[model samples]
Target: MSFTGSLVLSGIGGLVYKYGGQQSERETEVPVGFQSLTIGFFQARIRVFRTRLETLSRTFWRQLVETSGYKYPIRGVSEMFRSGAYFFPWARAFAFYLVLYLTIAFIYFCTILPVYLALLAFLGPIGFAIAYLHFLLHSNMLTMMVMRFTQLHNSLFDLALVHNGKEIFVKTAIQSPTLPKRYYVPLNTYYFWLNYLPWRIFIFGFGFTVLIVLLLISFIPIIGPFIFNALISPFIARIYFSRFLRLKKLDNKQRNDEFYFNFGTYVSFGFVAGQLEILPFVSGLIYSSNSVGGGLFAIKALDSEHAAAPSGATAAATAAVSGSQARQDTTVA
Candidate 1:
């Protein structure tokens, strides 16, 4: 993983050194493949799913090496907090929440009631601003953390894991039972309401569906959570890849898997990850690592069903062969 991460970084760094100079205007185009209309939407989506499965199996060798999914999320988050890059997002978010709260309070009490009612007119601007601030926190750290871990995930295969931040379009982990000692954040203790007080009330909140999904399946039986977990694992992986990881979205599956899939893993990874999201300054830091966790989950899920990757084939070269094989196998019964 280290070797592959280094190689991916080195390759990107070399590109940056060559063509990555800072410029005033910034724009990059989304790849045009997935957005195009297809003849059999279901069939096209199935083929794409097979391709993605093959890609991860062929590419995510490093992830395959791990016996536990909890390791990377733990370490990545620890590094984030230990270094203190995780706090900025929450601080910004809570600050906005506070200011907005106070402004409304003042309008309700301190100012004329009619004017306060009129001030309700500002909800559009205020709402947009609030959502924007929350969105702001998860993304910057997210893009870097995701791409790096992606390289790490695919390290053994060494496919060209290069990601241009341009592919980071609008969004999007599961771990086992581990009970920790009662704990709390150091400085930002007050911000915990982002998780507890507001259930989808906050403009920046990201875990509503996880709770819904978990509840939806809770009556089914013991395996409900795990059942939903496996069912939604690919969606979770793609979210990690595209949203927090800021990579391009993997498959065009809008036509299928809607009920079980989400760009945000809300209950599985998002719920677990959000435990730290209310921790003010470190929220984004901890949240950004969720992608790796999600990737590892997806890698484990897929590899369990597929054969081993070929030895000594550079993944970049063999991916075509692998994809072709997957397509040919489409007709297999």
Candidate 2:
């Protein structure tokens, strides 16, 4: 009935659906008596599941290190601070939101001060604790909204990818008229508001509601919040890949499938990114840096995938990039 419980149940169901459904066909092929078949089926399932678990664990650690998600956020923040252009956007975003938050907080404080005093008089220190928690929750809600809507950090993410040699790849993809249309999904304001915005709102609402429940369960301790973040981290991690996914031109279903296929990597990346995000007061700055880290991770991961891709596919990608370069040169000539 709890948020954690629901997550656990869903995770179990997902694993079963992902792996268990194959048993019927495999079981039919075994060609054995009922008793032996049952035993062999259980044995095969256990072995297969164990192998998958081990693979996922290894993938998690490898991705975590490769992505450098733990330190990228810090690096991103430092770079933003050092660069006037990057720093300006972050400052502007922070200042704008801070002023807005203060204006609303002032109004709320004025209206709630009398109620707080009455509660304190009747409930002693408990009322003060309740009020403090209320304020913390309110601030968190504002912080999340700002983080989601402010597009400032995404540029930082792109900058990171460009620095790591994705510029040519992305540029080619953009220029190549022959590239798959999916790879060139136009991301204008209309798309953002009409398509991306609504989905994000739904996800944010559901995720934050679960988080609030978890936080309230152990408001004074770190345990509940930690668990909540870890459980919800894969979703958070995917946000870091939004730009990269757009480049690949995956739809919602394809994107979700991609994440599910690389569940370990996503979870590990999200866990580290989520930890960085949990820092109070400076989350906007941290989030910006995390974007840089995500870019670095994505580049590394994609490079690895490129190496592993079939020779024909690699050749096609190369042709796309080369063709784009040729077209550019022709235009200049």
Worst 10 residues of 1 by lDDT: 155-164
Candidate 1, 97-142: lDDT as tens digits: 3443343334333333333234444677664554334323322222
Candidate 2 to native Cα RMSD, angstroms: 13.7
Worst 10 residues of 2 by lDDT: 21-30
lDDT of model 2 at position 302: 81
| Candidate lDDT values, in order | 0.35, 0.55
What's the CA RMSD for each of the models? Answer: 19.6, 13.7
- Candidate 2 lDDT over 1-333, as tens digits, reads 122333444455444422331211111122245553345434544554565567667676676566555565456666566666466556665665466456544554566444555666667787777665554444433344345434455666777777667898677644655422211213433434443356458767996688667545533323444555666677677767766765564433345446655776677677776666564456556677667777777787788888877789878998689556433221111
Q: What is the lDDT of residue 212 in candidate 2?
A: 67
Taking all chains together, the TM-score of candidate 2 against the true structure is 0.55
lDDT for 92 in candidate 2 is: 61
